[model samples]
Structures are given as structure tokens and as C-alpha cells.
Target: MNHWLMKTEPDELGIDDFAHEPQRDFMWDGVRNYQARNFMRSMQPGDHVVLYHSSCKHIGTAGIVKVTRAAYADPEQFNPDSAYYDPKSSATEPRWDAVDLCFVDKFPRIIPLSELKTLSALADCALVRKGNRLSVMPLSANEYKAILATTNR
Candidate 1:
């Protein structure tokens, strides 16, 4: 299965928020960037994800999630009242897509971005590349394991 790093603002929907959800899962929506939206569309059920908390006091990987559902039309895109609504989009031609993700495990402690930059194993990770801002990015299996190893240490 593919692995990915999905960034979210803790204040908006942190790992804790998912834990409290009735089904401990939520639809990942409102991705306006075409590249990011495409990444979500590429996800499949059971794909692994690293939940990264960004734009927060502690910017880091906070937890893990598994894709519970594949790509589907993002309802928000068709709702005029929603912030993510696209005026040009219609029910028959949705402009965005979303996936369902289920909480897997919260890290014992956040794997800080600063710490990530120091790891040689992740030097090539897209998330660590300068000026890279895509909210969702692919990660190699080795990169995934390397980050998980940091939590164990």
C-alpha cells in the first residue's frame, strides 16, 4: 500500500479530534490545490498515513491514520455555503475529491520538523524539502519506517 504524509492544523482538526469522532474517522476535504487533491484521489483503503500537525506550536508528525475509503466527490465543493465551494463546479462535474481516514495511533511524542530535518534517512523526503508546501505528499516505505523508529527512541 502507498504511504503518505497528510498535514493538518491542530487547531482545526488534530489527532485528538479524530479520536473523539463517533467512528474515529473523518472525510479529508477542502483541499483546494490540484496536486494535493490528486494525492487524496490516489489514496486507497488501507493506505498508511502520517498525520502531521502544521501551523501550530509544535509542527510535527503527531499520529498515524489509515485510509478507510478511496476517493469520492467532496461534498463541500458543491455546497455554496461552504468555504471550499467552487462556483464553477456542479454535482455532475465535481471539482474536488475526498477520502475517509481512520485514526491508527498517536505518537508518544511529536516527531518535530526540526528533528526530521536532522535525519539523513529522510533527507530526500518531500516534506523536508525546502519550499515544499503540498499538504499531502507521498512517502517511501523506508521513510515511513524511519520516522516510526524515531518515536520508539
Candidate 2:
């Protein structure tokens, strides 16, 4: 199965929020970037995802999410009043896509980016890459294993 990393602001929907959800699942929406949209398009059911909490203290990977639904049109993209609206995107040719995700696990202590910088195995991970700001990215098998190993789980 494909491995992926999805980052969200803790204030928006972090690990604790996911864990507290009734079904532990939700549509991962509001991504408006083209590259991020393409990554969602590539996601598939059962794909393992690293749920990272970004734009918060010690931004880094926090937990795991399972892709429960593949790419589908993001309804918010069509609403002009929505914060994620894309004027160029149409219902027939949507410019955005999103996937449903199910919370699977969380690290006891956050595997912060400060610590991730020391791992040679994750040297190529997009999350660790300099100037990288995409909300969603792919993770290599080795990088995924190495990062998870460092977490308390």
C-alpha cells in the first residue's frame, strides 16, 4: 500500500481532535494547492498516512490515518463563500480533491521536526526537505519506518 503524510494545523484538527471524533474519521478537505490536490488524487483506501500537526508548537508528525476514501471532488471548492473556494474550479472540472481519513494511531510524545532533522534515513523525506510546505506528501518505506521507530507510540 502507498504511504503518505498529511499535515494539519493543531488548532484546526490535530491528533486529539481526530481521536475525539465519534467515528475517528472525516473528510480531509480545504487543501487548495495544485500539488496537494494531485497528491490526494493519488491516495487510495487502506493507504497508511502519517498525520502531522503543523503550524503549532514543534510542528511534526503526530499520528496515523488510514485512507478510507480515495479522491473525490471537494464540495467546498464550488462555494463562493467558502474559505477554500476556487473561482476557476467547476463541478465538472473540479480543481480540488479530498479523501476521507480514519484515525489509526498517535505517538505518545510528538516526533518533532527538531528531532527528525537528525535522521539520515529521512533525509529525503519531503517533510524534512527545506522550504517544503505542501500539506500532503509521499513517504518512503524506509523513512516511514525510521520516523515511527523514533516515536513512543
Candidate 3:
């Protein structure tokens, strides 16, 4: 299965919110960037995801999420009153998409961005790259493991 990291603003949606939500799954929506939309379109059910909390005091992968549903038109994009509404996206020809993510577990503590930036192996990680802003991006198995390695350290 493909691996990925999906970012969410903590104030908007965070690991704590997922843990409290019924079934711990939420429809990831409102992505506006073309690259982020394209990445969602490539996802599949049963894939793994690193749920990262971004634009917060501690930006990092805070939990795990299993892709429960693949690509679908982002409902937010079609709502006229929605802050993420895109007038250009039609029901028949959507310009945005999102996936369903079921929260698996929350790490005891966050693996902070500062820490990620210091990891030699993660030097090539897009998550830590300068000006990197895609909300969703692919991750390799080794990268997944390397991040998880922090949980036990």
C-alpha cells in the first residue's frame, strides 16, 4: 500500500479532535492546491497516512490514519458559503478532492518539525524542506519507520 503524510492545522482539526470524534475518522476536505488535490486523487483505501499537525506550535506527525475511502470531490469546494468554496469547481467536474482518514492512534508525543529537520536521514524529506506547503505528500516505508523510531527512543 502507498504511504503518505497529510497535514491539518491544529486549530481547525487536530489529533485530539480525531480521538474524540465518533469512530475517529473524518473526511479530509478543503484542499485547494492543485498538487495536493492530485495527491488525494492517487490515494486508495487501506493505504497508511501520517496525520501531521501543521501551522501550530509543534508541527509534526501526531498520529496515524488509515485511508478508509479513496478520492471523491471535496464537498467544501462546492458549498457557496464555505470558506474553501471554489466557484469554478462544478459537481460534474470537480477541481478538488479529498479522502476519508480513520485515525489509528496518537503518538505519546509529537515528533516535532525541529527534530525532523535535524535527522540526517530525513534531509531529503519534503516535510522539512524550505517553503514546502503541500498538505498531502507521499512517504516511503523507510521514512515511515524512521519517524516511528522516535516513539520508542
Error of 1 at 102 (Å): 0.9
User: What is the Cα-based lDDT of residue 23 in candidate 1?
Assistant: 67
Give the per-residue lDDT digits (tens) of candidate 1, residues 1-153: 999999999998888887676366698998889999888888999999999999999999998889999999999998889999898888888889999998888889998999999888899988889998899999998999999998988
Using lDDT, rank the candidates from best to worst.
1, 2, 3
Write out the backbone clash pairs for model 3.
none
Candidate 3 per-residue C-alpha lDDT over 32-145 given as tens digits, one digit per residue, 9 for 90 to 100: 898988888999999988889987898887988889999998899989999999999899999999788887788899999988888776778799999998888888888888
- Global CA lDDT of candidate 2, please? 0.87
After superposition, which runs of candidate 2 have C-alpha atoms over 4 Å from their true positions? none
TM-score of each: 0.95, 0.95, 0.94
The model with the greatest lDDT is 1
Best by TM-score: 1
RMSD of each: 1.2, 1.4, 1.2
RMSD of 3: 1.2
